[model samples]
Target: MSHDKKCVVIKIGSHHTIAGFNNTELPQCILPSSYIKKGNDYIFGTINMLEECIDKYENESQQTLEIFTTVDENGIPYNWTVIEQQLKYIYETELKCNSKDFPLIITVPHLKNELANKVVERYFNLAFNKLNVPVFQIVIEPLAIALAMGKTSALVIDLGSSGCNVTPIVDGTIVKTSVMRSRFSGDFLDYIISERLNDLLKSDTFQMTDTDGDIILSNNDSTTRSLQTKDSIDIWYESNTWIQDFKINMLQVSDKELPELERYYKEQAEIQIRQQEQLQQYSTNNTEAKLDAAAIASITNNNPLSQKKNFLFKGNKNSKQTVSLELRECYQLSESLFNPALISDKYTKEDGLGEIIGKAIKKAGASVSSVGTNTVGSLGASMTIQPATNQSKNNNPFGSSIGGNASNNSTGGLNGGINSLGSSTTTPEHIYSTLLTNIIVTGATSLINGMEQRIIKELSIRFPQYKITTFANQITMDRKIQGWTSSVSMCNLPSWELAKWYTKTDYEKESNKDETKEN
Candidate 1:
């Protein structure tokens, strides 16, 4: 990189954006990708600002702030203007750097080549024209992640807030044909939890409360759902937040273990109830019969099991309530991730997370197949082939051709492509064992205690012949710094300055040439 220009690397994702100067090993700023737009002003840089904006708007129902740069179902950014503003805020305000003095290296996810290309073009226009930045470089997110993990080839799985991105990288390049994505991610789990909680609140099993900590009854003598008030809405929001935290704290096990864990909690809840009743009876007998302090002291001071069994929620007005979450309910909540059909009204398991991973693995194998063993510069990847299912010619599940023209076939269906590679050496089994063996799982959702293990277990069962090694950095710093780390590493190389960064003058000249041609 040019010594004259300060350089920065940024990793932009649907949930958060990480940015910092190239000289630093760690990111200088990490901000949530959220903003509230007012008439002529925009508030961003922290979740607090968004919360403040929300509170302000809630108070004045007539003036609602517009949310921007929110992630869509496929983990892609929805707004360009907000994204630019976020970058501008980070560059000028957070980092205290002038755009003109620095070049930018950004990481982006490939939501298929065309959409990815458009997003890249949009960023280029924003950096070159709007921000007047001196230079810019784009790195695909999977490639950056792979490089950060110190692997030239691996399966990169990003379970972000909005969706899951399964990308296979070989020799530090994204295997575009093998990449797969789905909207089923952390947010879906949150949604299901909230939905289940709402149902629980409406049922006779739980009671609603008002601001003054008073019980609020359902309209038809507790037979109907309780009326939703501002306090209820506040409680629901806080409950969801708590549930999200709970998921990270708990919910780690194989699907079979979920039921057992639930039953354990239920038994603990019963034990707690029995303990409470016994304590009450002992207190009543001692007080009524005028027993001494020594008799009261004989009872234990603490019960850890009782504490663990308790579940509580509060209304916005500080009204408190408690109920033990049924073991079955807890099991069902986590189970929804592996089997979406459980929550879906139509009961379709076609889009489950495991299925998505299997399909992605298949695509990775196909990509390796395309670059045959005999080809020069090939990674010498191997696989164990299985027979493919018959499918319509138009709907090839594995987007890329297994043994045919790789360039033309790049997208595939979710279910049909898992076994399409015929008898190739680069089968799912081989790919999972060799080049793609180092599974690097990243993103906020991966913080859930057992998520990494769950993936390893599931994939291990799917491809028994392969060794399914997985790596997940639980630290937030490591998760967000992958793009920046890769960028810094690239900049340190002698050829990077000459090879990658595109300057403003070059961009303007190209734009002018295009305009002139159009005229």
Candidate 2:
């Protein structure tokens, strides 16, 4: 096959793998990163066949089938065979191109040096030996995100299926020592939402009523179709697709803290109680006359707590059921990101996203300053560290009341500028300021409603000095496929710039050099 000279960008994420030619803005195909294994045979691109395959496996006792994900929580592919098969499927079936004819660009998460070298070697072997690609390159997820946002330096906060990664990129180089990872992410939200849904279903306060106002009973009840059972709950939670849909469509991060939200709901409940007492008193006083239906309807309409919405949950066997829940419950699902204690006992407030970002920034600043270098290599004099300006201290773009009372009093600030690691005179404040100002939040979980606003609010509380500005792709699809699109963008750069890409010839030379070394 003749080379097309077009670059193929493949962004392999934990949940999905996006692939396309570099000429397009968006990816041509986004497929699940999971494969179904039946006995010895592995099946790729099992999106449509997933449910059917699971159903078949359940129905047939003698047959055995297992579903496996190509990548792990860190987005590293552990199953090379499955990954190779998936790549072949993307190249031949989806993109309709030969792997040997075009250059390949893929994204990988930031790993330790030892692990990174091993991973790079594996990918190189797979690209040159297995797939026979002309050229191959690996781009770190955070670096790709920076490129997508058109920034040379950024504090990349990626919230994906596995977890959150706060990586700092200075002058297009990743500050490896400063990267921070947190478990409170999309998959964590899914688990939390599933548990909350399970609890809601089991709670006596929760009532599932149909459109006709008939109470729906659990599956164990002989009178009506049952939706509740230990097995069914487990199965429902295990369904990643359904849980992901619920999280994306229904879940939202609350801008306020848990205490504030709780207080508001408590106050509303108290008001409702008082209204009920008044209604009872009126009824007792007017024993001779019955209250009119219009009066009761008027009171009900006025009460915000009386209004309830139904969430339709589609289950197996084509069964569709509605579960009634307050909007507050849905918002509470994402609160765990800001307050991990809401979900897990092991995590403290320090484990929250804002705190992690703060720590990451501090670490990055400390790492750079420890080297006794005023500027990171190739960053230029324009990017040199400078003293805090008066404008940065007086002007706050995030507003005075956005993140509640600023923590500047407890944590010392440099000339009224918030330092991520409290007051530190030795650490260069400019490095922290630069990273804080250019924060880029991307990933699937970042697509949650009010996520960006909540992050800004949280960061503002901690770091009140710099006007916190975070760039997030407004379009959900664009944000989700950002890694793929960014790789495509990088591939469009000048040929000289792409000299870093490992070509077939380069691989051959390295192999020959290794052989010579052995001899």
Candidate 3:
């Protein structure tokens, strides 16, 4: 618990894992939480190599190599062995430090009690027994994210790979009743992108042609060369690296709603098409014709609907080809986050990102007096700090000890407890005011361009009564690793304040106590 001793901060995300020493500003290792298995050997953090292996063995031999993820779709560790292996690599190869030497702090997603308890117990066992870590603790991602932003209370909107989680942290404690989760997230957007791309490839309107403007293959062809085929699409999806690269490089949230943006672009395209026809029919002087041609070119160049970008698809063997997509198509992928109904009929307009945020705020506002009371019925995990004898009373069975003392003062720690609101009486109005003004958005999906601005625009329309102030880290890295960065900062606090960190001795004592109770 001492600040002098180095602490290891690890954030286990659904898609990626970030790890580093607490003293560092950024994570030392940011790698996929996945591994490739070939025979008895397991290769971790070699996604690019996996892609190459897939290409080499596409049709040459039986595919023996298999890729595995440490966590499930819900961000819970499903494969403990793989998770342990990932940690071992982080400690030995990346950090180049002995696990026994430092205290470990891990960040986990906020989930239901049964699931949260399972995740926590698995990690605690992994840290103490497997890694031989002397001290260990788990901090829910929302709390760490709040501390990282230097706010004890904020509406934290985490747009992660697995899903979008809108958690309300009141006085540094998670408002369990107010937490809202949705399936609209990074991976969902990826699926939407793949589906859209498939449709575009099959359509005659959008054709993939070579430099000479000739089609590469017949539309009916189902071979590897034709990306239009289902088999080829499956191959492309399997090479997740290329799709991930495309998402990161090209995806962006539109400034306006998808329907409005589409309408505007459609109008612009029509006007340009009419102008082109007029220029072709009318005969004018050479200078006038040249001027009109220049005007049309300027219009086409400025119009996003008319503008297209070519990306090389390298997922298939001997199938490297340029796929041209309208800029509007790229924007549509992220726009689905704002309007989930745009992609599928299963989701209604209420399932959008803005609506989720509004719902979380309303739920938090409704339960103002019960904010720090620690029980949220069966809908969510309880926030209550359990007695030493009862570990199952709360989602955080390790209790407030893991949270530290999240003071609103200069000294940063995990906030929550009987006195979370401090000496001053916090009314419903005061809590609502704090949450509305300090909205914090963090996660990989939030890194998309215009995401922060779009959220703000949406929130302003929903909550006209209050002044909305949303905070998103301008630094791209900071936003991606906000949870880990905050965990490191929490480790820097004084030893007494971080008493929440469970030690090996404490675990032993608790184990002995449990044994006695069973007898």
Candidate 4:
């Protein structure tokens, strides 16, 4: 099942994706600023941006990149729709041009680091990319973090300011046999804290004020231009907190539309009912005179003042309008958070990450797991970019960026820092899945984690004795891995410059020394 095509993984981060930062007049969204609240519902806004981004790629190289976006929805955060928006945008934009190569995998968000290598490099390349030009798909931020922290069997944690979740990995293959769950990510922690504080600060009038002496009411950051009446807050907090509105403008166009919708729907229903009655009435028997009279022949009077006949509109357009028809079948996953009769945080708190499995070594479960994995993740992580030691992840790009020359032979990100003894392809080419937690934060009602185990089991059955790690960061066993670990390093050995930090001769020697001491 191998084809010869390359796949690309382009991920936009929270800081870049979420907007309204300079602390404009808009009230800041306690969470990621990607949506605007329309009185009750959260309107998705990021779809426009993603559509624009995909257009850039397609226009440049005719490459209809397949995007597998993951979403994490814990504690009623409203960003899953943003991921949905991106998917919809991709589909509509590509479909308009009649594209078939544009496929997308939308699943729940994932956070473990070890799974990075296996999911993206190994499974993605071997399965998805091989079916097409499948250049390597790049791992985005959190996965990149797991790849950077050098360790074989360790827990990876990322508490980014926007969101937070932890991933556990063992060796290269994720310990599917263990217990797994998704808690309130760091993003949740931030907003909950903020909201709880606001709830406590009401006065006799029950109006809460900002840091300044102004009354506050909501969470959305939409207002753009500056006006009076809003008290002038501090200058420093302006960028982070002072946005009063995030919307482009405050026009209640929907109200005007509601009346028209109702009128149209009622009008259509009445027309249909009248037409049915007419058919039933005519079904019996009608003389030619009766039928012709019903058809409304022209009426005339001889010289009784100037008479003119006005014909009713006989257009083929439907006279009736549907006001609020069911757009999509919405299942009650849970009630909206902002609604009255707030649901308890206990059962509804489920972030919808993988939570169900057969409770076997083959099932790394989540709270919302089912059959096929809606949320898939790569496992092999840990990069050893030794250059730019002072700067943490400021690694060299493979070549220059897209605008720059593509003649760069040196690698970037987890590239370089490879002095391996394995005969593998690409830099740091032996990555493995240390966990099976593909934590897609997107809102898919059906998801599972055993798919990772299933992939592993099948691969094991096929290869028999060749330990199956991913293709990103290469893995090595001092001796051959008879389908098991001999001695594995997440990143290959360190380069000569980084070796100065190592008092020992090499990584292999260091690994062997640790093993010998354990014995």
- Model 1 clashes, total count: 9
What stretches of model 1 exceed 4 Å from their correct place?
3-5, 47-62, 204-243, 253-323, 373-429, 480-499, 508-519
> Which 10 residues in a row give candidate 3 its minimum summed lDDT?
375-384
Report the Cα lDDT for residue 43, model 4: 34
In angstroms, the error of model 3 at 506 is 0.6
Sort by TM-score, top down from the best: 3, 2, 1, 4
Clashing pairs in 2: 218-226, 219-226
* Model 4 spans with C-alpha error above 4 angstroms: 1-9, 12-144, 160-164, 203-519
**After superposition, which runs of candidate 2 have C-alpha atoms over 4 Å from their true positions?**
1-4, 51-62, 203-217, 221-240, 264-309, 373-427, 511-519
- Estimate every model's Cα lDDT from 0 to 1: 0.59, 0.66, 0.69, 0.26
C-alpha positional error of residue 44 in candidate 3 after TM-score superposition, expressed in Å: 1.0
TM-score of each: 0.71, 0.76, 0.80, 0.27
lDDT of 3 by residue, 1-519 (tens): 345788888998987899998777778888777776767877776555456466644665555665667777777789998889889988988999999988898888776655765677788889999999888877778876776566657899999988899988765566666788887898787777666656655664333455565654434556423444433224434435567777767787877787788788778866876776667557553334433566666765777764787777544343445677777877877888988887789888798898999888877776755433322111011122222323433434454333232122212223333333234545555666778898998997898888988988887777777887888888878888887887776666655344366777877776676567668
Candidate 4 has its poorest 10 consecutive residues by lDDT at 478-487
**Cα RMSD to the true fold for all candidates:** 10.6, 10.8, 6.9, 25.4
lDDT for position 187 in model 3:
78
How do the residues 1-519 of candidate 4 rate in per-residue lDDT, one tens digit apiece? 122111112233342222111112221121222433333443333444344333543364333322222332321223443444543443344323211242221111242333332233232332232323212222223223333343323223322323333333332223322333334332333233223223322211233234453644222322211111122111111112311110001101111123343455556655655565566567854422232333322211121112222211110111111111121101011111111122244535233222211122133322112211222222222233332121122211211110111111123322233233332221111122223222211111111112223333434553344454422112211011100110011111233232112211222343465457559
Clash totals for all models, in order? 9, 2, 5, 70
